[model samples]
Structures are given as C-alpha cells and as structure tokens.
Target: MAIEVASLPLPASADPSKFVDFGKEVKGIDPGNLTDDQFKEIQELLYKHDALLFRDCSLSPEQQYALTKRFDPASENYGHGNNKTGSTVKSILHPDLKTIPRVPQVQLIGNGTVYNHEGLATANLKHPSHTTFHKTQVSQIDEDAGITRYYRWHIDAALYDLSPPKVTTLYGIHVPHGKRQTIRYDDGTGDELEVPLGTTAFVSGKTMFDLLSPELKSLAVRTKVKYAPHPYVWMAPARAMPTGLGIESEGRELPLEELPPWEESKLKVLPVLWKNPVTGNLHFQVHPCGVMELLVEPLPQGAKREGALYPDGAHLTDIKEVRELLYKMQRPAIAPSLVYPHDWKEKDLVLFHNRGVLHSVVGAFTKEQVRAFHQCNLAASDDPTGPTADDIKKYA
Candidate 1:
C-alpha cells in the first residue's frame, strides 16, 4: 500500500500514449467514491496505461463489485468460471441494480439479447436457477458483407491453460447513439476501403513488440506460439459468417467445436515474445483466429525461421500457411495507429489489460439503441477458471 506516487489524481486528459481520462476531473465517477489511494492509483495506472477511461461514471452493481475488487489480481477469485451467459434479454436496466446479480462477476452485454425469441424480450427474463444445462439459443444466423459476425480479435482466453485475465473491467450500461457505420476493406489493389468502426477495440502488445525487426525481435523472443480453440471461425472478408467470440463457458451459447480432450490438453503454450509484468514492455501474444502451431523454440541451436512473416521460418507444417503468416505478423498491430477504439460513453468506466489488450466487438446496435455492458474478469494466478469444451488432443 505504498503506492504514494505524489498523492495521485492527475488525469483529466493525458492522451499522451492514448487513454487516461478520469472524465474531466471526475464528477459522476463513483465506486462508492474511490479512495485507498484511488485503488492504488487505478492499479498503478493499469500497469502502465494500456487503456483507462472513466467518463460520467455511475456504478453500483455493488459499486461495480467494489470497484472491481480494487483492480483485482484475482481478488479472492475474480471470475473466469462459474459458467455465465444468463440474459435472454429483459433489456438489462442497471441504474443501480434493481435486479441482476447471480454474481458470476457481473456480465450482461448487449445487442438486446434473446438471441432467438421467447416473448416481449422475455418479460423480466431471469432464468438462472442453479444450473440444469441445455437451453441453447444464441444464434448469429449469417452475415459477412453486412458484418454481424459479432466481432472478435481476441486476447481473452489467450489460448487457455490458465492465467489469462489480469484485468478487464467494462461498464457502460446502454450506449449506441445513432449514425455511424461505414466499414469496408480490401485495398490490396481492387477497391474498397472504408473502415471506421472499432468500438471496443484495442491492440498494442507493447506496440506489437515495438514494431519488431531486431531480426523480428529475435524470432519473437524465440517463439512458443501454439493454440487450439478453433472449431469454426469463418468471419473473414469473403468467407463471411460463422463466428465464435463469446465462448460462453459451458452454458451461455457459443461453443461449436474443438476444445474437448481435457480442454484440448490445455494447449496454450504462449510466448511469441513476453515481458509485461506491468509495463516492462514487449508483447505480441498472437491470435490469428486462435493459432494452431509454430514452435521454433530454437533461437541459438540452429536458428533460421527467416524471422517471422515466413519465407521459410514461422512454419508449423503449413496450417494454411501458418495462419496467413500469423495474420501478416499481426497486421501492423491491428492497425488504426495501434488500435484503441472505445468511444462508448453512457456512463463509461473501461479498464483493460487482459494480458496486454487485444479486444474486438465494434459496431452494429439498433433496435432503438440499447447497448448495455457490465463485464468483469481478473486473473494473474489462479488458472483453470472453468469455460471449457472438452475434446482436446491438438497440434500433434
């Protein structure tokens, strides 16, 4: 508790490295009126500012679960388990919680859920009576040119073997206020390039390892990338539909394939560069649709994977060309000048760093705009926090 950094409180706008605004000197901000040295100055400025917006704050889901357990480092189990996904849609109304708390760490995202009809948004929808499983109904149906893939860039499960969410608070009950949508892409020489639509976006793995090139940062700190969660993810430009971003544990609707064999043998072997123990720098977690392989762990035994983005290096036996050369070495750190898209404001209170930010879910809200959001996650150590598929045996 010695985080006395000059008695904190000086961020009414420090867009220096993008994001740090306690919303014009705090007014509507209330985590029961923060003070414990402002939750260790907001967990040491999100361990070196990856993103932290506060705007007109108006919490009280128990004060957003006691200010997210004061920047929880697993605050006596923050959450990742206890299988969530119980909100068929009563239009979630959280002014100070009249009802909505089975406590899985508060989660009730929007798009007016009811994923597939049941009646006037299922009057007072609240079906969660101590589990019984089997209620499937979170459809996407189909979309690609019109988008609705529900979006996802990912970093949450980071493959999953555990220790994924360090912090990822989000609170902004109901947003999406009209006019703004013009996304397009593919300009490699064939027209079409609009973009503008990056709502809950973020991607800055320490600037993707400071825009690598020290021989691709020594083959990304001697590679270790290997994942296994893709049973289906067709949401690309022309591939258009099939998605999977809301992997609702075991009962919230979202799993389709892959992840069974003891949770895919717990495959998550990360390390395509690492070091961010709260801003030590260097991050490039990699997630080209949940990677499948690439373990050239030889940085000095016979090194030569040609330094990322293949010519003949990042090869894990061609799983679609190592997933398009790791999404073209991670598309310039998910571009848009190192993505940080979060314009939400209805009572904003974002706080990211889920292992170095890599979010998704950007636009499309209209049914008379009612966007809702109230998530929570924490993990630094306390792995294996539920959410499985159970059909493992991956990557050979």
Candidate 2:
C-alpha cells in the first residue's frame, strides 16, 4: 500500500521563536494556566518536532507530576517503586545495586532481575483504566569490559499489549558531566541520524502509537496475561533442577527446558510504521522491544541440503538476520527530512507521541552521573479502531 503522508502542521508563526518565549526561566508550566492558543501551539510543535527540549527550568517532582496531568491522568497502578512520588510520576536512571551499597531507591529501570511477578510484565489492557506507567532507574555497567547494562534501543514498556502510550515524557534531573544524550532516529535513514542531549527531544505518544501497523494491532489484541508466562519465568536464567530429576533422565526433558531459554533470551524488535486510525497519517515509526515476531515456525520445506540456501518455512531466517533487519528499520537514515536534534538543560519537560518517534540514550555517561526523569502516558480509550473525542478528553 502506498504510504500516506500528512502535511506537517506548522504553528501560526513561521519561526518557532514567536510562539513561546524560549528564553524565559521557569521551573515548569502550570497546565491549567495554559491558554487554548498556547495549548494548540504546544500540540502543533509536538506534532512537528517529534521531540522538544527545554533548558534550565528547575522543577520539583510534584510539579512534574502536576504538569503531566495537563496531558493525561496519573497512572497510579503501573510503576514498581514507592508511590510517594505520586501515582503519575516514576523514576528513571538511578545508581546500580553493586555500586550503591544500601540505597534501594537506586534501582535501575531496565537492570536488576526481571521480576515477572512484581508487575513488570503485566499488560495495561487488562486494567479497566486502560493506562499504565513504568518507573526504571539506569544502572551502571563497565562498557570497556563489554558489560553494557543498559537496555538496547527499544520502546517504553512493551509489556502493555494495548496500543502504545499516546504520549511519553522524559525529564532530566541530574545529568553527568553537565551533559546527557539520547539518539533518536525519527526518520528511517540510518546514515545521517541526529544525536541530541536527552532534554532536547520532545515526543507525542499519540504520534508514536499511530505508527503501528495493522499486524501489530492484531498482536496488541492479545492481553499481557496471555504472554505473562514468558516475562515471568523465562527472561532470567532458570534454577537448577531437583535431585530426583537427576543426570540420567535430564536428556529427556532437555528440549522442554531449553525451549524457555531460547524463547526468553531472543530479542524481539517491532517495525517502524504506525498507521494512524484518526488522521490516516503515517506517523514516525516506533522501535518497541517485544511484539517484533510472535512465533517463528519451522519451514515446511525444511533446510536446504545445497549450499547457501535458507531453511524453507522458517518464520525468521536466523537471529543474525533478524538483528540486521531491525538495524535497517531503526537507524536514522530512514527519514532525514523530519528528524530534529536538541540540547539538554535542567527542569526541561518534553511530551511526545510514542508511536511516531524512535528515542535512545547516549552511551557516553556513566551510571553514577545521575540522569533523573519522570514519565507518564496518555492512553486512548480501549477501542483499537481509533481515538475518539472521549479519548482526547481523557488526556485533556
């Protein structure tokens, strides 16, 4: 199908400078105080820029959560840590367990053990609210030792099988070396991607969610509960077998035990295009972690006995091939015209569409540097067909 493109919605002013005072130094904006015109301008900028960055505004956690409410309700039930920050706010990027001896608050968002039962793998679709939040702190890893503990480029909270978040926000608290960076491949072109400070890119979750294809829509229909087994039991290494099932009989169940390891260890990355149900615009592509490939069945034709031929009927040719394809879809080379880069400053708030853009953290900083941010999601109503006026109202 020919991909449809929506004309970029530019704000009334040709230069973005005229819309809002970029030089003003305020910790954050009170969403309730925003005028309709200002809100419209902010919305248009979010759609056009994919990501926005504010500089030097100091905001308290409570203020950050209050600001998020302007866009979406507080997701009280989603995150894993203390709820003291309020239902809407969640922490991202904290000290490592080994490095920081006694601070439980230092849990890295993507690191530590994947606690399946601790609500890490549950889908938001099952909840009556249809909205969820995830709070993660970044852990330190010695990249020189080939121990990169950070998550590879993937979407936020893929476990939520419902449509991706309508909007996502990342606020930088304490950047290391006075700098933090996030690599964003808004356009597909792998070659000329933009790398900006973490604070510079603002994205709309709605735009991100809109980029998903119908195939993904079908997958999202399957709730988190169905996929719960894999997240809970499989991601981590298995415990040793009991004594009764000793060495002699181990071979009999080798395949069964091995299946979970393969299933859990393999990485899954989704395609970049999301078909917008409301505007029919093909928002920017999203690179989510799971939902990349469902079940890869063996080919009916079987492997070729001859040279260089792939096995017939294989859902995916091989893991290497899958990685290559994901790289092609993910890099910044895909869409050069739409990508934008920004610099980070303290107390800057960004709102973005989860479906439209691909975002990543710059690998330059160490874990102890302290990059603090709060995030929230503006969820569409349960209907997968499209967003309704009611859905818009929920965020409003």
Candidate number achieving the greatest TM-score relative to the actual structure:
2
Which stretches of candidate 2 lie above 4 Å from their native place? Answer: 1-32, 35-37, 69-151, 161-163, 178-272, 276-279, 284-288, 292-324, 332-341, 366-368, 378-380, 383-396
What are the per-residue Cα lDDT tens digits for candidate 1 across 1-396? Answer: 232222113222213353332112223335456788676666667767656667677676567766766665346333433332232121111211112445555556665443322112331222111011112222233222333222446665434545566677788766756544432223232222123332565666667666756665555555666665422221111121122222222222123342233356765666665555654665666655555568754444334544433324445855565665555566555544345455676887877766666776654544444455677764446432211112001100
Report each candidate's C-alpha RMSD, comma-separated, in the order given.
Answer: 20.3, 14.5
Local error of candidate 2 at residue 164 (angstroms): 1.9
Model 1 clashes, total count: 12
Q: What is the C-alpha local distance difference test score of each model?
A: 0.48, 0.32
Error of 2 at 81 (Å): 10
Compared to the true structure, candidate 1 yields what TM-score? Answer: 0.30
